[model samples]
Target: MSIITLSPAILDAQADGRGIVALESTIITHGMPWPQNLEMARQVEATVREHGAEPATIAVLDGTLHVGLTDAQLEKLAQAKHVAKLSRADLAVCMAERRTGATTVAATMIAANLASIRIFATGGIGGVHRGAESSFDISADLHELAQTPVTVVAAGAKAILDLPKTLEVLETLGVPVIAYGQDQLPAFWSREAGLRAPLRMDTPEQIARAHRMRAALGLPGGQLIANPIPAEAEIPRDVLAPVIEQANADAARHGISGKALTPYLLQRIFELTQGRSLDANIALVLNNARLAAQIACRMTLLT
Candidate 1:
């Protein structure tokens, strides 16, 4: 396979030994609204910098895979309408078509591996959706985690999905799920998903060591660091339960399925929660970015 071209900004960071954290672009194009999406993208990068690491926001624009983006690029992407949400299946097709694309978790992981970036931070990863048994609607993220060699720090799987089933899929795929500071897994907007994590690592160094160990053992896939949302920022499972149920019901009633399902449910949840869900979502992402940077810094020492 041919190499994917990266922006000069990302090239410099990778060469300079600065702890580089990979960020997905879908959050800018599909995860949030215009100005706020642009703002959040910048804030997440700034947060990584403040924590002693450089941020590489990955996306595909006009046939080019950008490992890090400039402010102009970020703004352009945030406002651009109908940009393809690129993932493992269509990443190369979009690049071949010379079209603009926002990298989802799987696409971002592929780009991160190409750029030799070891750590990635994102809000939440997609997984086995509810009723996936018949629909067969599993997210590409689970398979990507099983093959990509980058450490992904997220607030667990998105709360809208079946958390236990997602965990089972990860376990079946041989991916490690390490819950940070807590034994229970996080449920996106909520701090606890009411399920025990497969592994626990309390510090960045420990996480970094695990990454190193995997590489030493010649493991092919990455580890998931389930960093919980802050207590103050969390929506609490009890409070989120009813909201999620309502959102799921709304999706079913409206016949929303596949890719449309997540965004639809999220928007409904935002409305249902009076926008509290969006607030909590932003808080959790920033929290994950900070921890990813710390782990990135530790990995840098090894390199």
Candidate 2:
């Protein structure tokens, strides 16, 4: 059997040379609960379509790597339990074991590149977790950005992480971290992370050109486009800081670490914020989808 299974729509888009934006499925399986996850997935894909690009939501199901999922697949994955959250280190292992798995930013990029998709959209990218000096627990997403050739549009690193350290590591890895239409890097749920971005680009066309130019210059890795959440949907940094601190404290109290930490923090924040954080997440994801679609379209034009 072929390692990859492309959805009919994705195959058609590829045949027609249409713009395609890759989406990660971990947002559906691991980021949220049932119905809301399904709804967000649909809305995000719709946003990509509305912006003149196809959405390829990548995942691995029963040993098959799917470049794009159909509606039925999306529904199944949304409600599926025991889904492995596959990243760079374990994506292939999950496939070999014939397990259903959702792709993280790192795994998604690898699959996206295999499908020749040039852009991806997500709520946020993982980075250096807090207390990493001793834990040394950095996300594979950062290393993937240093090697994969897909431009990723995200709200920025999840706010629960050490933002400054994340930025420092990206710099060391030679990854271009460009804030979109702003000078400040966006926190996952907030418009301002209180850190100046390393670079800034105000237009999708400019971002596309930079992506191509990197390839021309023989640069390895993709660019990180830090797109801010729509202001109307953002939880102001001042308002969210305390809530995040509380959640972090709760996690530390429970000794929650590693893979369990992110989800626990997000869920706690969602509860503490009265569901506002999830709303912000959905808004940011849709916002990123729109920007990624525009960038993908611009890339097609440049091609």
Which is the leading candidate under lDDT?
A: 2
131: Cα error in model 2, Å: 0.7
Query: Against the hidden true structure, what lDDT does model 2 obtain?
Result: 0.95
lDDT of 1 by residue, 155-263 (tens): 9999999899999999999999999999999999988999999999999999999999999999999999999999999998999999899999989999999888988
What TM-score goes with each of the models?
0.98, 0.99
CA lDDT for candidate 1: 0.92
Name the runs in model 1 displaced over 4 angstroms: 1-3
Clashing pairs in 2: none
Residue 119's lDDT within candidate 2 is 99
* Ten-residue stretch with the least lDDT total in model 2: 294-303
* Leading candidate by TM-score: 2
RMSD of candidate 2 to the truth, in angstroms, is: 0.7
Model 1 lDDT, residue 152, Cα: 99
Against the unseen true structure, what C-alpha lDDT does each candidate score? 0.92, 0.95
